[model samples]
Target: MGAVTMGCGDSCPLVRAKVREEWNIPDPKDLPDDDFRKIRDLIEQKVTSLLAQPTG
Candidate 1:
């Protein structure tokens, strides 16, 4: 999967509820650009790191 995924504003209460309940994730789309950019960067870093990690 790609490092970043984008979605329209949170319109689905069930999806939002499930996400909040399960992941504890704040909606990134609601965040300011700088914050969302930082999240995007962090996701990229995590994906890169995972790809680099040694695997059996």
Candidate 2:
């Protein structure tokens, strides 16, 4: 679940919808295998932590 924008706000659909995107700095999109692995690991960590939270 990610949103791709053309750099401007107020015009971007996500901005208008008030949807917040993840903070994935350094543009890991077309990175090498190692970089991809690192990004994957980071996302996995976030997911694990989120799932561990108690929901009421």
Candidate 3:
């Protein structure tokens, strides 16, 4: 099992993950459209990078 956390901190609870990753992205709620798009793009880039990694 794998886990990806997006800056939720203590409000989120994830247990016993075989692979865990925490991405320190800002909360985009109520942000301006431009800022939201930038955050979204960052998340997309991070995901793309992760996917490009070779898995065991």
**Which candidate gets the maximum TM-score versus the true structure?**
3
- Candidate 2: regions farther than 4 A off: 1-22
Give the per-residue lDDT digits (tens) of candidate 2, residues 1-56: 33434223334563443333444445568999899889788777866875686754
Rate residue 36 of model 3 by lDDT.
99
Whole-model lDDT for model 3 versus the true structure? 0.85
Per-candidate TM-scores read: 0.51, 0.53, 0.81
- Least lDDT summed over 10 consecutive residues: which range in candidate 1? 16-25
- Candidate order by lDDT, decreasing, is 3, 2, 1
All models: lDDT?
0.53, 0.59, 0.85
lDDT of 1 by residue, 1-56 (tens): 11222344444444423222122235668899999988778667766776796754
Question: Which residues of candidate 3, in runs, are more than 4 Å off?
Answer: 11-15
Of the candidates shown, which would achieve the greatest lDDT relative to the real structure? 3
Clashes of each: 0, 0, 0
